[model samples]
Target: MSQNERFDNNDSDSLILSFNGDANHEFQEINENLGIVRDVIRNLVPLGAIKVAEGIVIEPVVDYVFESCKRNPNMVFVTLYYARGLQEIDHHEGDSVGPALRDMRKKRIECSELLARELVHKFNDQDLLFTKVLTKRYAFSQYDEISNRKNALDLATRLYSEMGNCGAIFLSDNEVQACVYALWSGHLVPRISRTFPILAVIDYYIPNHNLNFLENFKNLELLNIPRNQYLLDVFSYIMFLIIYTMVAANYNEIRELNGFLEGSMYLLVFSFILNDIRTLQKHGIKEFLYFRRILSLILHVILATDFALRIKHVTSFDHSIPQFHRKALSLVPIFLYWRVLLTLEAFQPIGRWLTQISRILKKSMSYYILLALAFIAFFQSFLVLENTHKRHEGDDDHLGDKNEWGIFALLVKGILNAPDFPGASKLENRFGFVLYSVYVFTVSVILFAVLLPLFMTAFATRRSVPEEYLAHFAHIVIRKVKHNQPTRYNYPSPFNLLYFTLVLPISSLSIIIGHNHIRLYANIEKFLTRIIFFIPMIGFALIETHFVNDKQDKEARDLDLRELPGLPFPEDEKQMLRRILYGLNDIKEQHRSLHFRLEAIESQLA
Candidate 1:
């Protein structure tokens, strides 16, 4: 029972609420996380890449070896494919899974994880591209046979490019895949990133969690616990706005009215900072950080710094710090608006929109990389062309002059559609002006070509099949919410810090204190939390439990979704809906009884 694992305070039944869709691990409960029929193909994809790479190198040598032989060579090359499944013999639904000839369908998981993340192709082995790859992949490169193209690192990179993030990310540490990342040259080298049987890794943190699925053949249920996310979001958002307003007001006017508002904002900001650290403790650094989280962290830091600056300035009366703080807070609006969107993401539609936006931002890193390259090229060229203006006579302050750092900033701004023509207005050299023109035009067109298609594909992703998008969006929201949930310090941020301040000191004291003392304050802390944050705790507590079981938060409480007069069900169709639901439940119970009786009869007959 770790802090982040949602402690049910109200003595409620620990339940798992499926969000937006239904999933059954009914067969998975019976089978020991054995591969589903659909997973075999995806699992073999990596194996296929390995086979192709081997054949590409070995078959050539094998053919040549036969050619050199005097007589007909008796050799056979065979590749066996095995995708074992036994739904009939093992799984719960096997009773109905008759007819070995029956054709089935693969679940539409929109498995982008299986897709290649990079370009993979046949290389000349001696290509300069393998230089770094080889050094990283092989330790005995010089001693190993140089002609053994069959073991080259080319295939590894190719497969990795295809497998992308699907490959063993950090699992390369087992001394297994670590030494294999040598090179792609005409040499015997091991594959750097091992072919992680992407399908066999059953506990791969799937979004639509399967409860009945477990390792060691145990029929255990792993829950994706539902909390009172609505109350949390609404309360947090309201608090966020209040804090934002204080920041917007420069922390002066708010203090004049009530010091608590200004003071509470600091606690909330600190609490958020604590939540992020707890998140990192729970989930290790991934391939990268989320854009929203990064921005939010930056925002928190700036606000925290501003709070510090306010305290220092009040005491010392320094004015310059305000300018620095203002400069940092200027970036807050961007982060703040994005934060608003993140808060709204508890709702399914908005959550999908946020996920899509995040995906677009994640995928468009190549555009940023290209932009950086262009900026470097253009900035250096400008400095070369008109870097040295006369100190006294010419425009010595020209941004392109030697030792000027403004050129770097100017170049970056130019790419962002805010072209700052330092040379256009005050250029002493014609070459400088010509270069600036070329830089602007070249960079703009390059961005247009690169970024337009990157986003065109975004719309296409959104237009994908409903079930696929639903599952994808469902998982994204679940992961995002889970990450934001606090772990270790069950107390949210500043509270966690404060909570530990007392507990930590008492535990370290020399005087022998028994468990009763800790138990006493543990109760006290919860009591204090209830008393202090009384309103939010109540809304959150009352909201988490629903005896009906299949409860959700956002839409039910949304004012916009509430039925208005003149609507299709003007007579309050919810009453009619409830009656319909009652009838459905009765029918469901009858069907269950009937199904059980039939099974009993069938078993007797068998």
Candidate 2:
């Protein structure tokens, strides 16, 4: 019979008391059974038979081992070895059995001094092994559960103290989001320092950090990633500005530069279209057609029309007025400004605040609608009064003059304060004069007084506990961004669209035909696709090195100093030591003074 089968058939009382009583032969048998069980577990796949073995064999055996160690403390070294094997198995299985192991440790099965040393040695060895496993696993799969990710981050941080670049691997999107969520939820800020290395890398890649022309340019170089969709929008907007500046200056000296700009603008427009299509696919038509997206669509239309008009103006033989082309180009800046505001949605804090503001405005929409109706009513009243008391063509007071009570002037003056009091009295129609007075009284007094307080109340009611609200908002943002599958979020312009349409599907089919190993196939395809685009990325990185400086280390040091609790002052070593001594002397003097005052009080009491 197999050893496992023989062990299973053994009496439970014999297994338990073999270590408890003085049965040397039975003790040897239990030790052999443990060795066999360990061998079986060590050979099994991490998540495979080991889990079954853990329940059927390992748990009961561990309990027997613990009882035996308790009865004969000299056997504690054997228990430690068994614990080490269990930990190794757990590590391979992603530490899912950690709680059970922790419970076993808490039982505190007895041990001798020599065996205790062995346990400590085992613990140190396991810690090093766990750290290595965590560092490697985090680099490959950071999207795991939060607890595992946190442990990995802690290990990375420790290793980074010993080896500089080891921590950079933990700067994945999942890690950053996790850190941000922790900080915003009132966790200590120092926990996020682990991600600083990666943040520095991103900062190096995209220098300005702020959303501007330079940042858009950097993002353009990263067009292979899906998260840079808004960056493409920003780049297109900047290109519009560039084209506008060129036309306004009438500088056509560098044809090559202009051609490059034009080609880049076309590419950005294509990227914008593909990004929009992706958004539509992910969110569906109803949710996709938000106000900002619609505004973007309108801007693209304007750009397309402007581009066509400019092309016609350039290609035509006749040098005509070009009025329409100029008109269309003039509208570009206005639309571009709107797109810039839309791009701010990617920044978490600002985006959350803007979303709250939008919600408030939506809730208060009826108030604004009523105010608009009131204005319309007042405007119509003023218009009718001005027409009824129309002056003759040869009148001394010209109607076009600023002081004249024209329709707009009357409405503005009445709504602001009251229509010119004397001018209303001088009107030919008494009924018009009375109508103007009532209109001013209704708008300037009742409407203004009522609406101002109503809006204030609405705003006040929306106020919340700032910290809790911020924490909640941050949690939502982290979850949303993490789960949104932004790994494929970027692909530059024409090439990205082609890759999605042609390359991805063909590769997917090949994988299905070969073995139906979906994950392996997808990973291989992603690696190959990224490798193809990485060539240009490398060139971009080389060019970027010229602009990016070595000042990040200094910046990181400054940030560290700022995070320290006390107000820190820079000084030479001698001066700092002198200051510390002086501070100690001051504390001594204060203590002496307090003691003297206490003696005086006691003497008076006696």
Candidate 3:
């Protein structure tokens, strides 16, 4: 007889002792793993299981699906088990998988014809255990079905006696659902899953998690395998959270830290993939058991970092200095673009205190306020134009003029022409006179061709002019120029608030009037440096805000549309509570028993 048979048939007392020792070690490992599994289950499972269960009359479709799968080893069950196993293997040691495992036996071969003694012993010793151990490991939950028995104790007895191959055992849906429920309910400790799902469950708990519950599975625990996979998931999730938090700080330093976050997330994802492949090889199926766990971690890290970087760049920016000071400022244009659409509507709570006050007083003063705003808008545009013109004529040395601005000096230096400006600077080379000329020409054309026509149209006798709209549009334009003032516009000399209030407005208006008469706006110096850098950044920010608003609107509309379909709506709070209760339910034994028989038959055929 083979050594394995000898060992298997040996005296029971010593074997029992050895088994007990092994079981103890295994239990310790599993206990450690359970900590992680519990976290994952907590994150993944829905919180309102109890309430959902109450409302969730097990539909005929779900029953049919469950029953149908029982007669045949369902793809879902096989896939989940196999995938989980492979992932575990990969996590333990990735290099040992794939071609390595397949070729390992051969690597130990020592002779051309004779069997390597170690290979013969290895095969003989492991083959029996491979069959029995694998079978027991996978079929634990389905032990009853494997033995064609009712009770778990009976099933375990049969398994011990029949000593079947690994392929005969399969976990049932009932067990998985039960375990998930149990974990959610705080009864059972999670053993296999990761923490991401637990967090998802928590988020879900916010809106809905309650359901009607029939069974409570709060005391379950995996006594065999370690929960290392779950631990890894938790570790990765924590890292992802850290990365996201740092990003949220809205500092340049956070973006600079993205490289570290990205690298760590990538490594964790890579580990998960390897784990997945290994599980496939060992379990003989594919499962996403760890897929989302890894993905969630990675996604959170990447998005958080990106968002933080964006916030930092946006909040640190000050538009009040340099050329922008003299110009009026509007947050809308600064952040608007097709790719980065933004709108004040999208950001409702930004300055709602002022907004609320305006709204409250709107009925009494809106028309007058609007009229005054129109004047402000028009006069502001004219003042900006005048300042821009004066700056162009008076400044021979752009560097000297930029230096005078102090804090804004570095930012505005590039707009000046290199060859014509007194000091040769980097901006002159990067943006030559040609680019400047094009910008100047475009602005001149727009002023004469666009604004002039619009102004003339306002004076037309037959048409009722919308002076308010013109004022608002002009306001936006002049506001942009003022916010971007230092790049091209000259500030009033006295620097006092009153002096700024009067001379700036008047000067801006004079430039427009003079341009209308002489077409002298054409001769105005190039503002290409301002055009290139300022426009895109501001435009992009505004566009981003708009798109965000549009997306939110579309989602609300979709939700409203769904409500029109006449589906019964559950009480949100009860639903959430039920989900939590249901998540803790355990029916692994029932599911495993039903599925094991089918899997055994399939295994026989194979």
Q: Which candidate achieves the best TM-score against the true structure?
A: 1
lDDT by residue for model 3 over 1-606, one digit each (tens)?
999877777767688889878756554443333333233222322333222221222233233333333322221222223223333454477566565542321211101001111111111122232222211222323222322212121222222122211111221112222222222222222122223322111111101121212111110111100121122233444554454345334334422435665455444444434544443553344233322334433443443454454445547664333123112112212211211111121122322322233223332354445444543443343334435544656654543443323312321233222223222222243333444344434434433453444444434411211222222222222222222211222211111232245434554765768745323332222132233224333433333233222111212223222334555545476346544544533356567777999899999999
Give the Å error, residue 364, model 2: 5.0
Clashes of each: 11, 5, 105
Q: After the best TM-score superposition of candidate 2, give how far the Cα of residue 19 lies from its true spot, in angstroms.
A: 36
Q: On residues 302-325, what C-alpha lDDT tens digit does candidate 2 reach at each position?
A: 777867776777777445525676
Over 4 Å off, model 1: 1-225, 250-258, 282-288, 388-413, 416-428, 465-469, 472-489, 493-498, 501-512, 515-533, 541-606
What TM-score, over all chains together, does every model reach? 0.51, 0.40, 0.18
Candidate 3 or 2, higher lDDT: 2
Candidate that would win on lDDT: 2
Instruction: Report model 1's TM-score to 2 decimal places.
Output: 0.51
Query: Per lDDT, what order, best first?
Result: 2, 1, 3
Tell how far residue 131 is off in model 3, in angstroms: 22
- lDDT by residue (1-606, candidate 1, tens digit) is 665445663223324433211223322221211122124324433321322322232323323323332111111000000111211222335446543322221111111111111111111122222232222222112333322222112232222223232122211211112112111000112122223322111111112212221220121111112233333544665677767686567645322323676677777777777767766767666512655577777788788787776676566656786666556656767777777676666455676676576567667778778877888887677565444444434566543344446567667767788876654435445666677778889889878877796678688767542223233333333343333323211444444566556644554552366544756655655455444444544333333222211222222322223324335433356346545755786899999999999999999999
Q: Residue 396 CA error for candidate 1 (Å)?
A: 4.2
- For each candidate, what is the lDDT? 0.42, 0.46, 0.31
